[model samples]
Target chain A: MSSSSSADSRRQFLRQFGLTAAATAVAGPTVALATSPSTMQYDDQKKLGFAIVGLGKFAQQQMMPAFKECKHARITALVSGSPDKARKLAREYGVEEKNIYSYDNFDSIKDNPAVDVVYIVLPPGLHAEYTIRAAKAGKHVLCEKPMANSVADCQKMIEACEKAGKKLMIAYRAQFEPFNLDAIARIKKGELGKLRQITADHGRSVKPTEEPAEAWRVQKKLAGGGSLMDIGIYSLNATRYLTGEEPVEVTAQEFSDKSDPRFKEVEDTIHFTLRFPSGVLASCTSSYSIQEVKRFRAFGDKAWLDLDPATDYYEHHMTIGDKDGKRQPKIKEGNQFAAELDHMAECVLQNKTPKTPGEEGLKDIRLVMAIYEAARTGKRVKV
Target chain B: MSSSSSADSRRQFLRQFGLTAAATAVAGPTVALATSPSTMQYDDQKKLGFAIVGLGKFAQQQMMPAFKECKHARITALVSGSPDKARKLAREYGVEEKNIYSYDNFDSIKDNPAVDVVYIVLPPGLHAEYTIRAAKAGKHVLCEKPMANSVADCQKMIEACEKAGKKLMIAYRAQFEPFNLDAIARIKKGELGKLRQITADHGRSVKPTEEPAEAWRVQKKLAGGGSLMDIGIYSLNATRYLTGEEPVEVTAQEFSDKSDPRFKEVEDTIHFTLRFPSGVLASCTSSYSIQEVKRFRAFGDKAWLDLDPATDYYEHHMTIGDKDGKRQPKIKEGNQFAAELDHMAECVLQNKTPKTPGEEGLKDIRLVMAIYEAARTGKRVKV
Candidate 1:
């Protein structure tokens, strides 16, 4: 490779793995010296090798491009349930044919030192198992959200990474998006004054489609719930982050289309309230049978900070103001997916925990569980 | 008075009340006839006379000035628990000495035709009694809020007015404030999309005082609770008006400094959530031991609207925007108090129901009651 491309590769590798200068100086030469016939060889400053495990639509469209442009990381391996699609993606991305793996041979990847990190972009139910297997293969993992279907599953995933001495990060993209970050920073800085309330909502209209025998998302054993686990988690996370206070109590109500067979085992809509220790109250809602909208607002004694389409799962805007005035059109430009990946890489390389760490995800899941329990029991649940 | 003075007076009166051409035709002749006692027989339309009761701080500052400038309304009478203050205020506001009345003589005013409206600016505990008395006296009534200390009191006030065939309006200034009205209009028009969440907060620091010889505001029996019943009512009303929906269920928590002598019988702070039938959720907070701030925000799919320092009890701003962009500083001009009084006068003169009528007050009081009950019972309360 040209010197410029070589430097770019090193930067990309460092960015992806969050490798600090000290860590790199120690492990860089060692990794280079250990290369053998089957091992991938790289200079101390070369890019870190990464692969996406699920060759699904989201992975093909969004995740692939993200890796391609990452300064410290590169798409060096491809894995998929479909061998044909994996080979196709490898060819299109200029990844080597030998670097491709299928579900059956995923274990063999342990010997492929070419790939250092695995991005698990599978369906919800598959995340825990794939992540744990990737950890056993000595690869750091970036898993798609809801962390896992249950608290036990999430704990298992975390423990697997711990045992492997590898980083495991949950993809909560909104936490890294600038607008949301700015809002959190402003709240921390007391821009809104003493925060007294937070309101968050995530809603969308997603009609049920007839799957060819089995679609993981429509199965309760896979996706957890239709809307709450899918989109409502955003509301829950955003509320906690913006308030900067742990919820002490929760009360929730849920409604489902019992007449609609598509709602079989999941809720179509859910509403919940969280009371924080600071006396701030948060009201949140998530719905799948509604027009799309995502928002977060924090109100204080002097002012307020608000994000419309706050958890857009992508780009959004932020506003800060008080009774006397407001500042808006505060542009938030960039892809949250890229931002989140970048943050995860930095956390891993720098030996720092992510802002939305495993514990945060676990806490959110706990709140979601509490909401479900409250809905079922018709009683307030202590968080 | 000279015809020129009479004409100038009429013009000033029209300007003060914000009367339109239609209102002028209805109220001008009667006011002119009433003021020109020597030259013209008293015409009811010209004699939109009003009495100021309870010459306390708020009445002395806000109501007195408002009455002075009201074109269709004149300060024809005065009533006070303190006779000396009543006589002095009557003199200062140009009321005839004979028109002055004390608490003992208030019933005698029923026989007098000069006063048409009784503006009860009393402490919360006295509102119901005075409002009921005014209704019995064949006078329209504008009662200062918390409407009353209890739901039973509010019902009594409403029944008294209904039985006497007079208009009864609550003094919820925020309902008439232009920016707030604009927010309600925008939300009603679906300018921000479909209402999904509303967050509101109102707070002010409690001033230290030593000579606490039973200040009615700090007394539980008189003020009901602390911040929730006092300032928090504004947040409740604003949330309902902005969403145009009554809350179906509520959950709340309250805090009190048990060790502080001041909080002996009332809450120091409160937080609550309201769930409306449209699946919209409202989170609100009120505190008396914090820096002052008031705000409200409504989020929808397409856009969002916010008012910071929303009910500043003075001035505020409104902002509107969507995920893609925003148009802020939308309606940040004008005095909220002036706007509210203007709207109230227009409502009365135009035979329009006040935006915050007795019913609106009742609903807010009901919600407050539910919140208090929920906090006490540690359970969600249906409204």
Candidate 2:
């Protein structure tokens, strides 16, 4: 990091955190009684207040609801072009009116010491812009994935955060997903011996010609690429985490029906194969025009672990298989969004880097670009 | 076809078929009453007898047993290199000693009018030789899937049958499997709307270092090309039939661990994508080093049909899914082997082309060879 010393910046960050906690305590004699039941699950002094940028469906539906269950994170601010939506959500979350900031004045969030983190959940194209601005505002940044449109943009986002001495973490919820974490733990324990193959298929029937809000997902400027960028990254990222290795090479194939107006702006499907140094091959596919399928499997010489509907927002199922037979194993489930939020907050308070930081997000985008190159050139590409 | 007059040859083929049935009728006036219960289930006179060539486990377990349930076919002869094994099965099935022939004396089966069709169930490498020899013996041929090891060989097998005025059929039981047929029927009737993509994953945990009899499956001389020729063909063939169109191009990738003894002679994993003329793409994969998986799905605009453990010897399941939700559909199942045996016999008796004819098998082999080329070259190859 370009900071004279990251420890010094982190100390400064915690000083502001300490001051906010002291102020909250001084303002309320019975702070424990005033807080919501969910807040009582964990120490509120260790928690970080986050300002969520972009009140999109994903932000409103998945993130806001998950905040109520977070042990180390709380919604302190809301940034949106729509003031009414932001005001209503702020009132519901007991967020002060002073913490509400529109995109036009998002820069002024720097004065609000209550928000120790700015979570950028905007479209991919705007990720770099908002992340850089957020870093300049001296708050740690938690950005949504497919970090940016290009490797250059991803690098710039990372460097911008480093220059400002603020930590930047890409919000990859899968890293905190319990079922996926269990699969990785099982692989490490040799439950599936000598992992030889990994297969992941994730897709949904998405009509790109729908409302502009949904159609932006297929626009090159907004989405950067099609299924491989939007949905396929899940499998790509999963393969990496499953093997804990980088792919040496990749070959990809993609198609989109031109006659279908939904595919006029972007490809609807992509299939790619990755070769890791251990000789473990991963075959992955993602489609916007196909049936919904969220499944992945890690195959080995002795047995295999399969997860059907693996990466859904909730309720993931797992099956273990061998020559004898297949059996479903019980799993302790948790909200992925809440889990990631707690993890990110923990990293901030402990002065540690997040598991899925900007560099990890950059690597995923690099592989996605390579997949596009291979698919376009009709040949294998070195990763 | 080399035949100067196909109609004349078909008539001649039916004349020989009629002669065999008439001879059987004349030999015994109480034929219907004297035959086994299985044979009495159908018209004894209308049934064409099949010479079971190569009494391997596949023939003995799947075919020899299915004949009892066939309404238009009956087992009349047994051919094998192992005399004791062939003789034992011959006795069990009530085959005359004269009808049983060794590989060395296989050509002499021509003198036995009771053997109207020679079912070649040998390894892929030997399919062409046996098919041509059977055609030369002037009998209709029901060869196993993967007509031969190469496209050139597949062509020769087809031509040999044509020149000898005998019909040749490839035994692709998937076409006759009840659940699969229902899926096709649903697609044909537009139950799933416009078919956009197809996916198939078929594999089994195979240790090629095991017994020689089972190890021959990984030998190029016997199995042709490891998993693709041995098992991957199921997904390849399924995609072709489900699309009802030939793939215009194919891209393939394969992997095997050099440290694993099971993959010493051939690759254990392969993934390929096929692009059809209608812009539909099919992603398929097969592996010898993974856990057992037999599944395929046809994704459409409205819904998708998934079959778990599809194309297995028995107990196929089907699930229908739409944007509304997923539902399991009850499918009236039938034994694939029995269904195919009946279909092949009906084709021979009616002088009609078999649903999975030698030409169909030739097309599949052509694509399989193309897949190998793509996998080796790491480039897309036109079919």
Compared with the true structure, what per-residue lDDT tens digits does model 2 show for residues B1-383? 11123243322322332233223212211101112222123247568989987776688888788988888888887766555565567767767666666555677777788889999887777788778888988999999987888889899998999999888999999889999999988998999988888889888877543543456566666667788888899999889878888899999888877677777777789988999998778889889877788889898878899998788988898998887878989988898998888888888888998888888998988898888899899889998
State the C-alpha lDDT per candidate.
0.70, 0.79
- Top of the candidates by TM-score: 2
DockQ of each: 0.15, 0.58
Question: What is the DockQ of the complex in model 2?
Answer: 0.58
Give me candidate 2's TM-score against the actual structure: 0.88
The TM-scores, one per candidate, come to: 0.74, 0.88
iRMS of candidate 2, Å: 1.4
Candidate 1's residue-wise lDDT over B12-116, tens digit each?
322322222122212211111122112222243564677777676667777677654444666778775454555567667777666666555566678778787
Pairs that collide, model 2: none
